[model samples]
Target chain A: MLNYFLFLVISFVMFAIGAYGLLSKRNMIRMLLSAEVMFNSALLTLLVLAATADPIRGGVVALIAIGVSATEIGVMISVGILFFKVRGEIDVYKLSKSREQKSRRLKT
Target chain B: MIDIIVFAILGTLAIAFSLLVVEHRSLVYGAISLGFLGIVNAALFALIGFTFIALFHLAVYVGAGVVFILFSVTMFREIPTVEIRVKRIALVIVTLIAISLAAIFWPYSNISVVAQSISYRELSKVFTEDYWFPFLVTTIALVTTLIEGITLARREAR
Candidate 1:
């Protein structure tokens, strides 16, 4: 019981930090890193839940989550690289501003 | 006794490294800290009886994810400095919300150790019998990602 509680607390704290990074950071890669951290907290939650109730199902689900996260990281890194190459920067705000500019140009 | 002790220690390590990953000035340093986070997370997974998951995490996250992040960061001429102002307050509010939610969903005294550890054979049985769809989906996803990543890089090169 205590171990389960401890695990949940750890996952929560990590999730919190990840959320902070995602919300606060301007860089695309840094935001992506935060997403990874959040993914990890999710993984931890799954594992702990499994350890408590159903191990087999939890293990399989966790495996799928891990694969999905890996794929996500790969795609996001490619996007970040492409963004940097084209814009010479990878700030999220700048990306949005560029989109807004394009939309304004289109409207004109 | 041992589980609690180990969990406390590793959990602290995981949280600290994750904080560093988010707070570090240098992108390369942040990515490296993320690698340590992965390693510690894998250990935490292992401590809870998921050896395969731990190994997979170390392989995919620590090995591949960290390397990819580092490589992407190195492409920049200067390390990006993140300036976060208002979000720190948002972070505290978010933390409180998360804790309250966890408390609401708290499964108190409901868990018992069914087994200290699970063997690979049991996991294989589950994979083959019940959860084959997810396995297939993951396989497809990984293969598609490999092709897509390669093509993206190749396109940029050309």
Candidate 2:
């Protein structure tokens, strides 16, 4: 019981840290890393729940979730690369500013 | 006794490295921290008796995923420095929400059930027989991602 509780606490802390990063960071790559951290926390929660109740089903779900996470990250990185090539920068604020400038120019 | 100690160490390392992943100035260092975080997470999974999941995580996340991110990050020449203003209100809100969630889920945590020890063979059997459809769907998604990734890479190359 204590073990599971501790695990849950750690998972929650990880989630909070990830949330902070996602909310506060401007770098797109850093934001993606934050999302990955959140995904890890979710996987930890799933595994701990599974460990307590149903290992079989939990294990299967974990396996599929892992696969899906890998594919998700792969696609995200590919997109990030393409975005960087097109924009020449990965900063979220800069991208937004560029769009705003373009809109302002068009309005004038 | 031993398990608690090990879990404590791994848990602390996981949290620390995750912080580093977010706080580091250099993107490459952050990516390296992310890989280390993945390794620590895999260790936690193994400690919880999920050996296969641990290995899979080590291979897929630490092996392939981090490498891909690191490679992409290196392709960029300039690393932008952005000022990060920490939001105290957000921190307080996240803490409150986490505490509330912990309280809500506290009852389920007290069941005192020991997970059954299942062999890989049984896990494989269940995977093949019961959850084949989800498996198929995941495989399809994976294949589509692979093709999309390849196309994107080729476009960048050209």
Candidate 3:
């Protein structure tokens, strides 16, 4: 009982903090960090599940998840570069996507 | 006894660094914080006995991946220095709601449905047999990723 509860604490706390980071951070690089936290949180939980199950397949699946995370990091970094190139900064506030909102208000 | 203690420490570090990465306004620092978190996470995985996964996580996440983020971060000439003020009431209300939901779904304590009903050995046999092909596919996928990553770097340079 205690063991399961421990796993529970690890999973929930890690995931929630990650989610909070994702939601609250205004910088793109911070967003990326939050995203990785979210990914790690999921990985930890999945590993605990695999441990509890003690199945060989669980380990394999865990490997799959690891591979997925690796690929995701690869893609995310490239996207981050492109974002830097176009916007020249990571501040969420400075993104030109909101330029239309500002211009509309100005016109009105 | 020691395992639990270690797990607790690593978990705390992971959560703290995660928060740091999220809250830090400097992009470079955020990226560095993520790198630290990744290394800790890899250690946690190994401690849990997921050796292969942990090894790969370290190599791919900490070694190769976060470095990529740091490099991408450097591509920017100007760091965003503007601060956006968040409304207090909205922040408090949302935080309260999130806390309430989390309380209800509290893992271990109330996630009683996570019945420890299955055996790990059975699942391992099944995976090794049926999932071999999928494993190969992932290897291929990584190779493709390397190709794509190099091409993207080149294209962006141009």
Candidate 4:
């Protein structure tokens, strides 16, 4: 009985905000948080899409997605820690610039 | 009628909290907002009859994910200073793309609005019998990731 369009709109708006944060935020942890939001948006859409046919299936799938996302957070947090240990900073801009320089050096 | 009302309120709150998650200056504040968003989404799941998913979402996402994020935020306590970047064009482009995708998908939403009743037993049977391979793979993957994370973090400790 819920309006599926309404739910989709909410998910899409959340996704846009997350994408904006991912792009604009320089902090690595915040970027990860934004990524979580984007992941939630995808899960929301999937759940809503499957709600009408077989919610149990959606539930199982959502469970899998949730587990995968948790693993993702764990691995990424470890990487963030490693990055901070090596660089003493967690700014995405600086990290990306360094990566670009590394790539250019390899090409040379 | 009640379902629609509940869904509306939950969806609105989820969206609002998600915005706060993205826009908050403090990392802890953003993580808390993200937790709230997860809670609202779990409620939204329940409202639509996915009770088991809602419960698991609440337990895994709101319970574990938020705590993990908070722990990560605390590990690097140095607050990042705001850097002004000329990213207005990027924002506009992302917004336009999202809006177009929404418009294109709107018609399909109306077609599948009906909620069919399904039980947890049915889901488990199907998951174990048909998609058991994926389920087993996920378990293995999770365990491996945990081991890798522990190893990675411990190396820093040493």
Candidate 5:
């Protein structure tokens, strides 16, 4: 019981850290890294719960989730590369600011 | 007893590296930290007696995913440090969410923590027999992503 609680706490902390990063970070790559952290936390939680209930099913789901997450990271990094190539900057704030300015100019 | 001690050490390292991944100023260092976190996570899975999942995670996440991020990070010679505009707000939101989650999950704290040793044969049987459809979908997604990645690489080469 104590061990499970400790693992849950760790998973919770990781999830919080990931959330903070996702919310506060502006760099696209950093944001993706943060998202990865969150994904990992969720996976850990799933495995912990599954261990108590059904290990086989948990392992299978985790395997598929890992595969899906790998694909997600690959696609996201590719998009990040393309974004950098086009704008030469990967800052989310700057991207949004540029879009706002464009809209304002169009309104004029 | 030994497993708990090992898990505690790995969990602490996982949290520390995860923080580094988020807070590191240099994108390359941040990516490296993410890789380390992945390694710690794989170790945690292994500690739980899921060796196959541990190896798969190490291979896919640490090997391929982190490498891809590192490769992309190298392309940017000068990455400006991202300024945090709403640290207090973000902190408040995260705390609220964490508290709510804890409350929801408090009932399950009494569950036993037994390390179940799962073999590859049983895992494959369950994967193929029960969850084959999801597996098929995942395979399709993987193939599509591979094709898309190849196209993107070729375009960049041109």
Candidate 6:
């Protein structure tokens, strides 16, 4: 019980930190990484629960989740590559504001 | 007992490396650390005996995904660009506080901890046997994602 509780606490703390990283990081790669952090933390939570369960299914589900996430990571990495190809930098601030300015100007 | 110790150590390593991935300036190092983190997670899945998921996790993540990240990171080689970095001190402090608060509250609210329920067997069976529609959907999703991945990578080759 104590171990399980500790797992949850750690996982949630990781998730929150990841969330902040995702939200606040100006670099696109960092944002992608923050998302990964949030994901692994959740995966840990699932495994802990599965471990404690009467009939353990946690590992199986986690496996599938990891597969899906890996695919997502592939996409994110590609997106980063393409962005770097065009922009020369992976800063979200420069990317978003430039796009936003274009749209705002076009609208006006 | 063995599982608990392994989980604790692996979990700590995972958390620390993930933080490094988030903080590392070089995209190459971030991607490399991310791959290691993914590998650790896949191992954790294996220890728990989900062979199918672990295999795919290794195949798709550590195999193809990491390669792709490294490929993209290398594209920066020809471009003389200094990476635009993250520098939000206030955001970091706020995030630290939020994480601390969440860590305090999360353990108490977990359903399994509250119910002392061991539903792992049930969920596994439910996933494999009678309730398999979701798995089928996941299969289709994986196929489509693969197709999309290939398409996304293919530049107009004349």
lDDT tens digits, residues B1-158, model 5?
67768887998999999999999888899999999999999888777677888899999888998988898788886677657779899999999988888888888777757777887798899999999999999899989988988877777522
DockQ of 6: 0.38
- Identify the candidate with maximal TM-score: 5
How many angstroms is residue B85 displaced in model 3 relative to the true structure, after the best TM-score fit?
Answer: 4.8
Instruction: Please tell me how candidate 6 rates in CAPRI terms.
Output: acceptable
Which structure among the candidates has the greatest lDDT? 5
Candidate 5 per-residue lDDT over residues A59-106, each given as its tens digit = 999999999999999888888777777788888899899999999999
Q: Which ten residues in a row have the lowest lDDT in candidate 1 chain A?
A: A1-10
True contacts kept of each: 0.58, 0.55, 0.41, 0.65, 0.67, 0.31
lDDT of 3 at B9: 88
Alpha carbon lDDT of each predicted model: 0.82, 0.84, 0.68, 0.82, 0.87, 0.67
How many collisions per candidate?
A: 0, 0, 5, 0, 0, 6
lDDT (C-alpha) at residue A107 in model 6 = 100
- Model 6 chain A weakest 10-residue run by lDDT: A54-63
Predictions' DockQ, in order: 0.62, 0.59, 0.39, 0.63, 0.66, 0.38
For all predictions in the order shown, the interface RMSD in Å is: 2.3, 2.3, 4.3, 2.1, 1.9, 4.9
| Prediction 4 global C-alpha lDDT | 0.82
Q: Which of the two candidates, 4 or 5, achieves a greater lDDT against the reference?
A: 5
Better of 5 and 6 by TM-score: 5
RMSD of 2: 2.4
Q: Under CAPRI classification, how is model 3 graded?
A: acceptable
Best-first order by TM-score: 5, 1, 4, 2, 3, 6
Evaluated at residue A90, the lDDT of candidate 2 is 79
Model 1 lDDT tens row, B3-80:
768777898999999899888888888889888999999998888778888998899778987888788788876645
Give the per-residue Cα lDDT of candidate 2 at A84. 85
TM-score of every model versus the real structure: 0.92, 0.90, 0.75, 0.91, 0.93, 0.72
| Candidate numbers sorted by lDDT from highest down | 5, 2, 1, 4, 3, 6
Candidate 1 segments whose C-alpha is farther than 4 A from its true place: B79-84, B107-115
Q: How well is candidate 3 docked (DockQ)?
A: 0.39
